[model samples]
Target: MSTHRALRATVVAVAFGATGLLGAGVASAHVTADIYGSEPQKGGSGAIVLRVPNEEADAGTTKVEIDFKPEYALSSVRYKPVPGWTAEVTKTQLPAPVKNGKNLDVTNPVTKIVFTAQPGSGIAKGDAEYQDFEITASTLPSTVDELVLPAIQTYDNGQVVSWDQVSTGGAEPEHPAPTVKLAAASAGGDDHAAMASGSGESGSGGSSGTDDTARWLGGAGLIVGALGLGVGGGAVLRSRKAGKSNA
Candidate 1:
């Protein structure tokens, strides 16, 4: 088959794979956070929501700790308030000096406030609890391609849920490390064809993203070939006209 046809086939295959994997929603554990509002950009202001699910089935959640990746150099961060629980924002010193100053506080605890369930209200701790937190922050890294945030979920008894995994494939990681996905270009800007081709880094050892890259490359090659053909045809027409004039 022609190169163009091959490229087309590759694109179709890649798209099919991406769709299937994305639809699977291979989530890992109960405690999880999805970056909704603002993307993680350096010096950009946005909001993020944390989705905490009851993983233990029997035991309910009591605490959660969000560890900030120091490389992002996040200085200012605030959490939304949750009822029945007191929240605390803590900071840790980064090994390297950040843009602002000292160590970066790792875990920004949104809700320390305990919950009182219906059956166990005021008497026993709650059961099957789920909560979310909205956070607004600035001073994220613009240079880096993307940002990663690993979260920990704590149960009433002291069990913790750590959803910290990074993927190499284009597919979203199962229990993916919470990430502030950044575009190669600035927001509202055009991206390179390669970056736009959907070669997103996966949180696991999957080839999903790599497969996507192959598809993109195929499509790109076809377009390039078409443009080349047009140029060549124009050159041939011009040569014929020159020969007739010389005769």
Candidate 2:
């Protein structure tokens, strides 16, 4: 077969593997967050992506909101501008102060971050379009093994969906909150110094972001691959019919 045909076959095969692993409902899950790195170092900063995908057959996703767990206080939060969308950040006094890895504390916790699609500009469900809102969060909580973040999605028709369920070790929840586990601290000063010597902090940050993006895109990529496979199959059938007519 041609190079394109082979590529299509590969894509379809990979998608099949994912389906088997994640179950049939994997393709229809609600909007989810994809943190740039799987395990954020305690007291460090990292990139994050909240992927909002519209599930409505005819409506577009009009609004997205993420609520950080109240117990974990982020020292710094930065949002990137998405053209044709507006972002809002809400802050509230924490019931109690939160601590970071370096023993620093934050009094006010960032409560909610909302992103709204401008009219005639947001992603349409029919177009298979999804938006990834990027942000950088710093001074992560050191105490928790995992951070559970809940999100709300709004459609063009004003329908709202909430993905707020927390996953325990048992059966998966209907809607699991976006969770990021914290990596263990370095064992000793020697290893820490060696790590520091090998690369600058910026280098480490860049690598983490790239890895996170790859993880987030992997599932979405399968959808594109499946479509390519369908087109390739159609082409093969057409070619076969043409050859039979000529015979």
Candidate 3:
């Protein structure tokens, strides 16, 4: 083929590839979490499993960090061990004291946990791993209806994926971070009760998140279709011009 034709073909190919990529990125772009079996009952003890995904393309996931909400005010916290990884749990002091009760002296503390993946645990390119961490705690706050676990995923190349975007009732921000939600409080529980309820729903149905992802992929496919048609049209036009020139 002529140089001009070859270049046109390449342009079309690139556009088509870009469309597919855009869709794939949207489909796979969230730091998702799951609370294993059930939501922690108000003022009760329970076990939770957090699922975190690696977002970096070039590097493998090296570390995962999670910060617990002060509302939980968990007296005890623990983690389940995983193969090929090292886990560390730290209890952080609050900047200002939070009132637990008239006689109860309590402060807003944080649980900062980090997980370092083994050398081979660095997930390969175009792949991801769902790391589950089992956390145990007791006597949660009733007002602390929702447990928001904002996590940061770090890769071997120092790329950090921060999943801290919190959603309000409406009007989401651009490039918002992803967040793992805990069960909200019950109707009579408190305002925070609603938060826990919502979290409980998410925990039970893992498929909802996947649906949102599928929509993003569909959008990407549409873009690819448009680009493919444009490239094909260009090719036809060139062929017509060549035929006329020969005639």
Candidate 4:
């Protein structure tokens, strides 16, 4: 191949490669939910952490809303206080009374939870900036293997992103909703007490590990992107010099 053709090909490849890396970084920065420590067993109480990332270049995340399916029939819901955020829990009357973990009938079940940032406080605008919001359920529904929590994120600039699509045929959707998979119900013994104590002891460590890994990956992506740009620039410079010499 001629010198000019080789240089043009190099630049094109570098540009496309860099763009793909950057796109992957942005695509992975979506809201996710996971068990705090040990997976919660069916019909047992456990804590769940919702990791919300700020993806907008010019706007910070100002509010988040998570909707619980009525099938969950959750009897009690509680949230940990975040310094710069306020949490609101909403409940609605169920069509029929359902039996709770305690064997008592529940008429109203929690349907939604909303978190709003206080004045001047929000998840700062960046791909790496995020906040983990936690909520503990008094009892988990036993009928399903996983809980799907659809979320809506509102930005400071009034842009809203909805994470509500459910995967079909094992294929993930563009804006897949967050989910928490439950473990099989415990055989007997005091499962609730065990889960609470275990999570309390190990929750912070688990969360920290996850955050650290995420930061490392983000840093790596940035480095790769920078290198791609440098290579592309160098190739263009060489191409221009060759053209001048050929003239």
- Measured by lDDT, the strongest candidate is 4
- Per-candidate TM equals 0.49, 0.64, 0.54, 0.65
Most TM-score-accurate candidate:
4
For candidate 3, the TM-score is 0.54
Residue 150 alpha-carbon offset, candidate 2, angstroms: 0.1
Which 10 consecutive residues of model 3 have the lowest summed lDDT? Answer: 192-201
- Give me the overall lDDT of model 3: 0.57
Tens-place lDDT digits, model 4, residues 7-48: 666656766665675444233467998653467778877677
Q: Compared with the true structure, what per-residue lDDT tens digits does model 3 show for residues 130-151?
A: 5555555444555655566677
State the weakest 10-residue window (summed lDDT) of model 2. 189-198
Clashing pairs in 2: 36-212
The 0-to-1 C-alpha lDDT of every candidate, in the order given, reads 0.50, 0.67, 0.57, 0.75
Task: Give each prediction's root-mean-square deviation over alpha carbons.
Answer: 14.9, 9.0, 11.7, 10.0
The lDDT, on a scale of 0 to 1, for candidate 1 is 0.50
lDDT of 3 at 197: 18
Q: Which stretches of candidate 2 lie over 4 Å from their true place?
A: 1-28, 36-38, 187-247
lDDT of 4 at 202: 32
State which candidate, 3 or 4, has the greater TM-score.
4
Quantify how close model 3 is to the true structure by its C-alpha RMSD in Å: 11.7
